[model samples]
Target: MLRLFSFGSGARLTMRTSEDAPLVICGHGMVAQRLIERLVALGHPFNGIVVFNAEPFSAYNRIQLSAVLANEIPEADLALKPQSWFARHKVSVFNHEPVTRIDTDRGTVTTAHGRVQAYSKLVLATGSRPSSLGISGEDLDGVLTFRTLADTRALINAASTHKRAVVIGGGFLGLEAAEGLRARGMAVTLLHRSDHLLNRQLDTTAGDMLKGLLAQRGLNILTGQSPAALLGKSRVAAVQLNDDTVMSTDLVVIATGITPNIDLARIAGLQCNKGICVDSRMRTSHPAVYALGECCQFGTHTFGLVEPGFQQAQVLAQHLCQTSEATEFSPGSIATRLKISGIPIFSCGRVQAGPATEDIQWQDRPEHRYGRLLVEQGQLVGAVLMGDTASGPWYADLIDSGRDISGYRDTIAFGQPYCEAAA
Candidate 1:
């Protein structure tokens, strides 16, 4: 058995004797696994817990989807701490069970399998679904969204037959899909609505350079273009742009974006906007109920990335264990820098330059390298670097922590020696 807890300041927790404490966790995703581990470590035992997960496996690292799609790693390798992890922790896992509704009044949740269970405390960790472009022929056979293992397996099989493929969107997933498809011997045409790829994470100049590098690898990149419609009868045959120009294609991969899955929370009458709203403690609007990961929006920030989701889980676990206190999330403002196809791109804070912000840029034409730093009020507000972005983390850390770097401002830009006392 385990201990049952209630919501209150300095509330006493009752440890279970013969009867097990009823603590139900819905959605067995990344954040849920971490929370489960934390609960186990805290000596909290659950009584006949019901965990609903749509995926067949217990849990897995979703960030490796691109590596799986690229055939760099096997599907089984993506799995998180195996099924034994749940067994050892004494948690009843309901894999492939999608929860339909949660009854807040009765403190219970109903699954698609027609099972209803009571809970002392409930957790919502239902992840997100792939965004679809509202276009004709989207339901066609060859059109796909690479979000799950099934989707990646299908894409790998389709890649064998398709000589040419078009990817819609220019974000991390879209670029990964394009690179993976290219690795599979398919000519990939990346169609992006924005003028720059990874626009949300990189500046226009760095994005353009990344596009050029991708193009040099025989990947066709079409920027500032939106798909008017998918030109196909049954399976995908081609994709038509807004200019009415049709590109030959056999497969159309749409990586537009992802929308958080908050239907269950909404059905249960929980406060939700964009995602399930939670405070620093990961506590929802309802008492004794909590949420984490991409499904929950904290402090007007919804982190779609894995690292931040894991960080949120760690913070929430600490709160649940009564260890370290919870802190407010400052997502989207945090440092984001990652490599795409060996090209380094980094961005943090406000890269959008204006009169209030001083923009200092340096470009090495021969090396196809560019770096821009945005300074405001004696602080490094933003930065963007490409080709040679090894110092991305160094610069991003400066912006995130608001470290004083005015002394080395000029030297940092052009790889120059500091101007004597300015150092």
Candidate 2:
């Protein structure tokens, strides 16, 4: 074993080309930052840590990319931490140098520039990649995806000159992209293959309500449609829909979906499904290798949300520290809360109803308010709200706790204040 300088208290750290590799991490995203912070707080068990980041900048708030695109916040405000923080924590980060290969047998990682780093243990947090539309004209100069800061910057730059923009997909990212482009004074058209917006999160009623609200904000909304091809000579000049209808546009932002970045791990012979397979402890097939965040799959469930990733990061940190309080990761209910073009929306638990489940809905057409509660076995199992979301967090709690709402069932849809007063 070769001894390296320590990161904490000047203790010596050791590694070997054969075994007992040094601690190394790939893909320094938000979840990776969380794990590093936890380890730092725990006094760091390693001599020092090395991080490979594909992005030029250090970890930042990716959740606010749309906000930056909308000009609601400055790009500088997205930074979570500066390089000095990592230096102080004794972390060596290779910014913009993505790992190209993983030599599991040699216990080393090779970078794009051919730099090799040995690790005793490794953590994979490569996150995900935005999926393409898989159609012709997709290679046009103005066509792009909205997954990273670079993508956001490209869209913002294009919006300055592009007069018309078309966004495909009605999911969260797609809606946000449409709204951001509209805020930039572009004539925005949003196309969704589903009958309504946010079909996966809200039922038809709520989805329709959201669609109407966005349309009222001057966005051209087209439902149950998808682009057959992007049309232009050099850059995108128009989009051709499946019905053979064409709308002239200068830019196209595709937010279809994301696929986990599992190629490196998969090539290394690690178990991978939709993502890198991990046990409850975030352990991969190899004992010395672990994975977390969007790159990890626990059982049949894969994570796309940050909350689950945060939970996984915490569990992995504890297990690696060998703390007494270390616990297994269990998937839990996650809520969706979003604001598109200044309109608030929220949904949690089961948006869909099962045979044994019942749905109680409320609507105030004059007030432009709507709510729905899913009850199963007399417990609040799901909820969706639009227009007025002050009760969103409270509703989420009830769903998470599985509390019986039978006593206040009649007034539950009215929100927590009324339910509390009535009880």
Best by lDDT: 2
Local distance difference test scores for all models:
0.80, 0.88
Q: Write the per-residue lDDT of candidate 1 for residues 1-423, one digit (tens) a residue.
A: 554544345554454432343677888778788777777776664564557888877777777888888878888898878777667766789888887888776566768876666677788898888987888879988999988888898899999887999999999889999999999999999999999999998788778878888899999999999998898778889898999999989999999999999988987889999999998778899986788888999877887777677777777666656665545544545667666776666677786888898888888756878889899887888888877876777777778788777778767675433334345
State every prediction's TM-score relative to the real structure: 0.88, 0.93
Give stretches of model 2 more than 4 Å off.
3-21
| Model 2 lDDT tens row, 44-127 | 677688899899988888989989999999999988888799899999989899998887776778789667788878999999
Q: Worst 10-residue stretch by lDDT in candidate 2?
A: 5-14
TM-score of 1: 0.88
Candidate 2 TM-score, C-alpha based? 0.93
Candidate 2 lDDT score at position 118: 86
Best-fitting candidate, scored by TM-score: 2
